[model samples]
Target: MALSTQYADEDSQNVLIAKLDNAKNVSNILKAIHFKESATVFASSMGLKVTVEDSKCVQANAFIQEGIFHEYAVQEDQVTFKINLTVLLECLTIFGSTSAPGVTTNLKMCYGGYGCPLQLVLEEDGVLTECSIKTLEPDEILDFNFCSENVINKIIMKSECLKEAFSELDMSSDILQFLMSPDPPYFRLSTFGDAGSTHSDFPKDSDMIESFSCTQTQTNRYKVSLLKPSVKALGLSTRVSIRTDNRGFLSIQYMIKNEDGQICFVEYYCAPDEDVSDPYS
Candidate 1:
């Protein structure tokens, strides 16, 4: 590709792979679709600034020491961010005008020539609580500095709800909550033993992606077998995602429950490639 022709960041492609890998569950097929879309959206949002491999993503942890487990001194959960959304919004406003690639636009900016990639900040009691930016959106400084922490927590409501499902092996109870939402993409997830998928009104044959039980081979290691992989590619038809083949890398955290009935978490560290694509998706 020519330099003047412009290219999207290589990391965007990787994130797409990550999304596809996470998209395996039969319940929240849309989340995989959403993850895949984030890459395209990131590309289109950055426009000329976002060239092939221009951007890098970091999943920094909010660490706490062995002696810092006290209630008042608990390590504040933080996902450190260093972002460049200016060029990003420009690309997104052009391509993401429709929701095909999971473009999230502000209602206010929609009429005002579409804003930029937004930085949604939530600060309460002198602590920086949350900073969420729409993956592909116009440049909009939606600085919602909330006075209360409750409102900011709502942003990650899905992560919490999904934890409920992940904590238990059976998903029958959790599946009953949000399957029939009249929304375009209702995202949900399952871990290890469950299957998931997405549904779209436009696609007549759209259905749920099935998941299955997986056994842990070792700490933080798992394997599941399937004939056809559940997710998409890292680049445009260049590579595919696999379960054991690729080391999973997540921008977010994975919720897990232990045998002791307590909540635990895992972050995607890495993945192999499409050749190792696992049916677990």
Candidate 2:
């Protein structure tokens, strides 16, 4: 049977259908959270969410809203599936990843009921490519519940400031410590390594800090290896928001702007390393 015909019925019976004018928009965002090979995808009327995790200690989510898609439809309250992100990314950019003059790739993605492979159709410069990636059984995802009400300290800053800090981070460091307070040392990031320790501090009133609301002094430590993946998002982002909750949980949000000047968000959540006691506790 032809590929189109094989999926024609499935398409009509599909629980989710999404289309993108430019595949690069979705490809670029997926790259930000590509640390893991497999990712859980959730589809709803609100949008699509792709989640990746490492060692159950760190989690990253990439959100692509329905508004970003040229056509979006969802027949169910929620549709969940797991797929190899590496494969999906490759299929999304099969035509060509890099930009060329007057060239763009269009994408149509469809998912039938359970146990069906994800169907993808790509077109670029008059060329069409089709891909079917097998979907795996869904896995239980972690819930961090790091809500705003639980946030103790939050800071919004330009990505440029954090980019430098992340780039120069000492890999030798086992843990990255964060200290936020309303008093002196309003915002601080420290890494202790064989060469000793390095600290990067941002003044609350600095131009780089757009907003600072720190009610109490809080200090927490997280595995350096886990948070390193966020650098991908930081590099491509224009703004970043840092928040620490009362439980010492950390959340970092990156605001990325696509080629079309549309804004998308990537976020990371990390559990504190309990081996190190919280100074505020």
Candidate 3:
């Protein structure tokens, strides 16, 4: 079916309709948060927010703003649903996962109210493919109550520097420690494994650091397994913002620029490993 004809008939019934000239843009962002099979999606006038969680301790959010879409319409104030991330990524990359120099895949996505499957239309060159994927009822999402006002330490740095450190992280370590202080060792990442304790420090005056703000000395630990998935996002981002709240909650925000040079954001929230020593000590 023609893309226009398909939407023309369902326009009135569809609660959400979005069109993107390059489907790879969305696919690439979604792939960064594909740690979980199922993801809850919340759509609003602002655009789409897809949330993927692991063990209720870590949550990843991918924000694709309305401006990214060539055409975007949301009849309701907000629409929420759960979908299979694996299936959605596959459908978005049906033409091919890799980008071809002259070829582009256009995507049209529609959701018809509640209890309706998400309809996807992909067109590349003269070929067209359609897919309907089942949607599930959304579960209660966790609220970390993390706010900027409660942030004790925050650092914005180039992702390339952190990417190398993350890629070399010792998997044998159960917990990854973060020490941010106004004193010496301004920013540090530590891991204690079978080999021994290893630390990577970034000087506050380093060229890679875009911004650095540390209220006091704060040391917190987070599970390596939970944070490992975020490497995908870090690998694609140009800059990353790392923050830790008074409660020791960890927030990592990645500023990703898509193929069209548009900025998008992916965020990860994680609770501190409480079994460790006092963070303020």
Candidate 4:
């Protein structure tokens, strides 16, 4: 499948997006219930990116369906990120916020592809963990409140050292504010820690590399060809509008027409230049 690039915000030449949950909500209308993971993964404009506190703080896996970047936070220093598990949420800009400003809104956010990147590393012994959306604050501190000891213990067991050191937190915390990060729970960083464990079900790959963090846009015209990555299983081809300013770097512009509808839109993005071949003359 050809790859398109996903940007962070919407502009004249940016990609488009669609909120996954909203689609399912409207799919059944009266049901108004959220769809399961895959539906959201495949259809989200701006995916509902979240962090998980795994007990095996040793590793994490990326969500194959949504194509988001989910993995361990392996820093260049070779030290694994440790966190205090509490409220784990991704700090992303809601692209088309003009519709429903403060609610738990949904839209189709444009993006590059599934396979994202890794965000952490273990120092000293230099170990790496993989799962979904891995990374944390080295100096972060957290506390569990209004919860049961069993819940805390369960979280602890599940998070392993993550709760103790990986401190799962939001993107705005003082600790997270300065840290680099990843979005999708499953992404393509290095093929090593990515294959994960046989005890787990994350897709395996032996050839992958880390790159710049990508972005998303809001649109309704994207087509899904593969659902094998990120919590957002969305796969956008090199369709839609794109142009480069004479430079080798490529830029894509996604135009979304809502017609008479206020929510529907056009989304698009540019994929890695190296990933795609020259267009047919």
Candidate 5:
């Protein structure tokens, strides 16, 4: 179902509308953050932001900017709602998750404000599928307060290199340690588990190291389980930015390029494992 070209019509209806040429672009991004059942969505003229969280300790966000959509509009300042991510994803890929040689799924999404179900109209090769998913009370998202100004260490690198490190991580380990210093062993990841201790390091001058900055030698341990989900984002990204604040909280941002060559971003914020005592403390 193609949306009306006139913004006045969309605004007068007091509804939010957005249309995308390809549904897979949205499906893929949501899949990366689909570890949870429910997601809180915020829609504005800027774009759509979908957030998933676990125990308020770990949070993941998928951002699909307005630039990626053929038409996007928000009637108010913002529209907020919660949805069953699993059901929404299924509806988005009803036509099929994979793309055929020349077939494309076009999607028209709409929301009629609070207490209204999210409506989706998907058409592919002249075939159409319509879905209306019930929306629930939006959960209160956690405020990480992880500002760049508070970041004590930061590393920018090619995702390919980190992808290898994450893939080979010792699953037996309950915690993964990140070591960043201004000296040798510039960056290191270590895991201690039933088998043994394993460490992977990246040199500051290595080609894979796009940029590295560390105010001081600092090491922090994070729950491996909390970080494992981030691999999904790492796999889809071309480059990644890793940062840790003075409190030792970890932030990993992935730069993903969509099928249309538009840049989208997915990020994960994880609280440091409290069981692992801070050596510096």
Candidate 6:
């Protein structure tokens, strides 16, 4: 159905409505954080935030700013709902996963208050496909309570640097260790597996590093399984910011540039593995 004819009279009833010139932009960003099957979506005038969490220890958020959308409207201050990310992705790429030369898949998404199915309308080359995916009650999202004031170490670098390190990480390792200090071996990634231990270090003055601020030496360990999913976001981003709080909590924020040259952000928050003793101590 045509977007205008379908939503002409229901404008007042819609809690959220967004139109995009190319649906692939949204699909591509969402795919980075598709580690979980379900995600909670929060929509407002600013934009849409989709969050996926696992094991109560790790959380991932994908932010699609309102500026990315051609038309964005929200009747309420905030509208929240739980959705199946797998199903939503399938609907967004119904026409095809790849882009055709000079062809774009247009998308019109709508939500009619609570208890309404999320509506999706996609049109490409005069072909229109409609989908209505059921939405579940919103889930209580986790708050890591990570703040800048508590950050002990922070580093901003090109994603290419970390991408190589993550790609070569040892799957046999149960935990990934991070060491940040002001002295030599400023930043290091270590993995201890059955074979042995592996360490990759980046000098504080490396060209790839855009910013480096370390108040004190800190070494923290995180589960390899929990942090693995973030590699997907890292792979798609141009730059990334890695931060850790005094409590040893880890936060990674990826800066992603979409097809239209618009910037989006995907962030991951992870709690440190408490079972491991502090090796530095």
Better of 2 and 3 by lDDT: 3
Location of the lowest summed lDDT over 10 successive residues in candidate 5 = 1-10
Stretches of candidate 4 above 4 Å error? 1-240, 257-260, 263-267, 271-281
| TM-score against truth, every candidate | 0.19, 0.94, 0.96, 0.17, 0.94, 0.96
Model 6: CA > 4 A from native: 1-6, 278-281
Better of 1 and 2 by TM-score: 2
Q: Which rank order by lDDT, best down to worst?
A: 3, 6, 2, 5, 1, 4
Query: Candidate 3's residue-wise lDDT over 116-201, tens digit each?
Result: 99999999987889999999999999999999899999999999999978757675788899999988889999888788777889
Q: List the residue pairs that clash in candidate 2.
A: none
Q: For model 6, how does the per-residue alpha-carbon lDDT over 91-131 read when each residue is reduced to its tens digit?
A: 99898856569799999999997899999989999988989
- Mind giving the per-residue lDDT tens digits that candidate 5 earns over 1-281? 34655634654565688889899899999999999999999998889999999988899999999899998889889899999999999999997756578788999898889998998989998888889999999988999999989999999999999988876778568899999999989899999877777889999998999999988888888888888888888889999999999999999999999888899999999998878764423
**What lDDT is obtained when candidate 4 is compared to the true structure?**
0.21
Model 3 gets an lDDT of 0.93
Number of colliding residue pairs in model 6: 0
Candidate 2, lDDT over the whole model:
0.90
lDDT of 6 at 113: 76
Q: How many backbone clashes does candidate 4 have?
A: 91
lDDT of 1 by residue, 164-196 (tens): 333443323222111112233323332333355
Q: List, in order, the clash count of every candidate structure.
A: 40, 0, 0, 91, 0, 0
Whole-model Cα lDDT of every candidate shown, in order:
0.23, 0.90, 0.93, 0.21, 0.89, 0.92
Name the better of 3 and 6 by lDDT: 3
Which segments of candidate 2 are over 4 A away from where they belong?
A: 1-10, 277-281
